[model samples]
Each structure stands twice: as C-alpha cells, then as structure tokens.
Target: MSTAETLDDVAAAARACRACTDLPLGPRPVLRVSATARLLIASQAPSTRVHVSGTPWTDASGVRLRTWLGMDEAAFYDGRRVAILPMGLCYPGRLPAGGDAPPRPGCAARWQPRLLPLMPAIRLTLLVGTYAQTHYLGRGAMTERVRDWRRHLPRFFPLPHPSWRTTGWEARNPWFGAEVLPALRAAVAAALAD
Candidate 1:
C-alpha cells in the first residue's frame, strides 16, 4: 500500500502488510488504534490465538491486563479510548524450548512512526513486556524498569507482560499490587478522563 496519511489509511495498510513472509502462521496483523485514543498499549507480538482471532489481546494475558488497568472488556476493547499496538503486528512463532519468539525486527520501525504521529491524543503509553520496554526505553531489566516506573512519568508506564508467568513475579514483589497498581490505575484514570 501507499503512504498512509490518516489513521484509517494506516490501519488498512497495516492489515494488508505482507512484509514478513517468514512468519509461521503467515501475516495476520492484529491491532486496534484510533485517532481519539488517549492510552496506548505497547505490547509484544500477538500469540497464535490472537493471530487466529484477528483481535488484539484476546487471551488470558488480556484478561489480566484489563484488570491491571481497572477496565472492563468493553472499555478495554473500545479503540477510541485505548489503542493496542504491539511491537510486531503478526505472531512471530514459538521458540523451540517454549514461549513466543521476539517480534520481527522491522515491524515496529516500519509502522510506529506512521501510526504514532496520527494518534495525537495518546496521553500515556504502557510498555507491556521486555520487547516494548527495550524498544522504547532502551535496554534494561524488566523488573528494574517496572520498579522505577514513576521516573517515566505521566507519559509512559512500564509493566511486565500480564502472562501467567507474572503470577509468580507478582507474589515475589508484593509492592507491584500494593503500590504500582494503585498508581497505575490512577494514571490510567487520569489519561482516560474526559
């Protein structure tokens, strides 16, 4: 597709993207964005389920994510209020040992610049997981970045990916629930406030 000048145009182009032919499930880009979006969910690549479903955040991880943000499924899925854009639009396949592979190197670089400028209303971006945190905030340990989330300020909130694996991490760091969550919810409320 040609250069996209509007949000709709960009979305269309992203959906049609076939740049990554090596993707295991082929290219089924899953994302949600709108010009009015105030909060951005900057996540890792979609899981196989999400690629098949053609919707962003449709798995267990999504459930926990919505809980973290104190939003219902309806509110979370409302593109006008929240934009869900991952580092990789398509599923990059699984690692031999386990877990999903890292996002394709070029996907975000190819699309973020085009999409972000059009989303002038985005007040805060949630970097959900190592990929997003690294890409946006530079190299750092996930725990450190999340622990020091306040330094990123009203513009960004660093978070661990809400996969089942986090259950253990949450237990280890009780402060995440007691401190970071409340602050995160407040930040989200402020960002989404009318």
Candidate 2:
C-alpha cells in the first residue's frame, strides 16, 4: 500500500481506539499525518478546544509555536510537510486543581511505536513540552533539555510547552529566544523544504 493509504488505515484504527474508554470526556483522537511529511510535532495531548475542533494546535499556544518556528498556519498544518501527533490521542480531561490531567496513563507507549515508524520521511521531530521530551529523550528537566538543543540535533528539537505558563520561563531564559529558536526555525525550514 502507498504510505498515505497505510497511514489512513492506521488513523482509522486510532480513531476507533477504545483503550481509554473511561476517559472523563471520552476519546477523540486528535492527530494528523501523511507519508510525505518530514516534520513531526510531538506534543503532550489535545486540549478541549482541539478535541472539539478536531484540529491540532488551534489555540493561543499554537500561535506561540507557529511564531517560534516562523511558520504560517498553512505550512505548519500541511500534511505533506508536517505531522502533528501527541503523546495522548485524546483529551485526558481536567484536573481537580485546575489544568488538564496528564495524558491518559500509557497511551504513548501503546500507540506511538505503532504509528511513528509509518512516516519514513520524518527528518525533524519537534519534541514540544515535558511529556513528549520525557518520553523520547528520557526523564529530564525541560529547561536543561531545551537549553541543550544542539545535543538532540537535526532529528529532535526539544521545546517548552508554548502555553501561557511559559511566558515567565521564556523571560527568565533569554538564551532560548536568542539561541535555540533560530536554530529551531532553520531546522524546521530545512526539514520542510521542497
């Protein structure tokens, strides 16, 4: 089968996944991929807005991420260039304290290995936020991991979550803006280049 057709089959299976049948808001897998995609946006999980919209990164955080990559929405969302996949396919629901809960317990370990390899063209993976970084790069502080972006190289670029919570973090770490972002954007451009 063509990669697109194979991915379509995989997506269909993911959409019908009942692994988290007891999820608070139920399961609504939110991911996008294509065989031609060279960039992989590996994030934590879907927020309520993304779940409702059936689109990835449609909120303010998305704006920040797009800005960080110096990409317009069209390019970022283009399936042929980018694949948006999260640690959790569904919105794990809200926490009693406030923010959303962590992505359903073992979702990534269960699904990612099965899904990721299908995209053979992926050359640059933006490991956004703690969950994704922790999963792929192993347990580590977001600051340290993000600071050492060069270590991850052309394959993985670690980044803090682009949520409002990161405003203070970003302010405290000027180097991220002065250093990492430029390299990140350049790598993104290279990966998505025709």
Candidate 3:
C-alpha cells in the first residue's frame, strides 16, 4: 500500500478506538505516521483546537514546533518525511492548574507498537515533550525530571513543548535554544535528505 493509504487506514482504526473513552476526556481519532516516513515527531497530545479541527499541529504550538525544527509549514506537514504522532492523539483537556493535562497512558499502550513497526524509514525521532520523552526515553532515575535534559541529549533529543507557556521556560533555560535547537535542525535536515 502507499504510505498515505497506510496512514489513513491507521487513523481510521484510531478513530474507532474506544479503549480510552473511560478517561475524563472521551476518545477521539489518532494522528499518526505515513509508512514511508523518515522522521518521527513524538509530541504530547492534541490541543483542544487540533482535536476540534481534525488536524494535528493546527495551532501556535505547531508554528513554533515547525520553526524549532527548521521546517516550513509544507515540509512539516509532509507525511513522507515527518510522521506526527503525539503521545496521545486526542485532546485530554485542561488541568485545574491551567495547563493541558498529560496524555492518557492508555493511548500509547494501545497504539505505538502497532504504528511504529509500520514505519520502516524512521531514522530520527524527536521526543517533543515530557510525555513523549518519558515514554520513549524510558524510566531512569537520572533522566526523570524534564530539567535533566543534559542527561538525555543527542540520542533522543528531548525538548520542552513548543507552546506559548514555554516562553518563560525557554527564557530560564537559555541553553536549550542556544545548544539544542541547532543540533535538532541539523538532524532534521539530514534525515529529510536521506
């Protein structure tokens, strides 16, 4: 099957998912990868706007995310080179602290194994938030805190989420933008070219 066909079929399966409906936020469709993807973008979950719009990365976070990766909108959305699968596909809603809640554990447990095996070409995976990092990076006492990005640098390239809320965090963590972003861009460019 063509890559788009593969992704669309996976998305369809995710749409019908009832696995995580028991959570406070009911299930919505999954956002996923094309079979031919060379890079994997493991983000958090859909923002409420993205869930409503039925498009992944259809918000300001997406804009900053693309910029961070040194990709334009068209390149960022190109499924063949970049697969945008969040830790959770649907919006999990907001916490009382005014932050978006973490992705439901159930979604990753149910989906990633099925989806990842399908993408043979994924060379570089960007773990773009705490949830994605924690899931992919595994539980280690040394790398548990998001602030300990130094511990997991280069290999998985853990990054803070590209949300407006991160502006303050970025200001505080100047080394992230100064050091990590250039390396991230180079990695993305090389992967896309390959």
lDDT by residue (tens digit), candidate 3, 76-117? 888777788888877888889898988877788777877887
TM-score, cand. 1 vs. native: 0.97
Ten residues in a row with the worst lDDT in model 3? 140-149
| lDDT minimum window of 10 residues, candidate 2 | 1-10
Write model 1 residue lDDT over 38-141, tens digit each, in one string.
99999999998898899988999999998998999898988889999999999999899999999999999999999999999999999999999988999999
Which prediction has the highest TM-score against the true structure?
1
Model 1 pairs in collision: none
Which scores higher on TM-score, 1 or 2? 1
State in Å the error of residue 170, model 1. Answer: 0.8
Per-residue lDDT of 1-194 in model 2, one digit per residue for the tens?
Answer: 54544677888888888898788878899999888899999999998889889899998899999999999998888888899999999999888999888888788987787788889999999999999998998999999999999999879999999999999999999999999999998999888887
What is the lDDT for 51 in model 1? 86
lDDT of every model, 2 decimals: 0.94, 0.90, 0.77
- Scored by lDDT, model 3 comes in at 0.77
Q: TM-scores across all candidates? A: 0.97, 0.95, 0.85
What's the CA error at residue 106 for candidate 1, in Å?
0.6
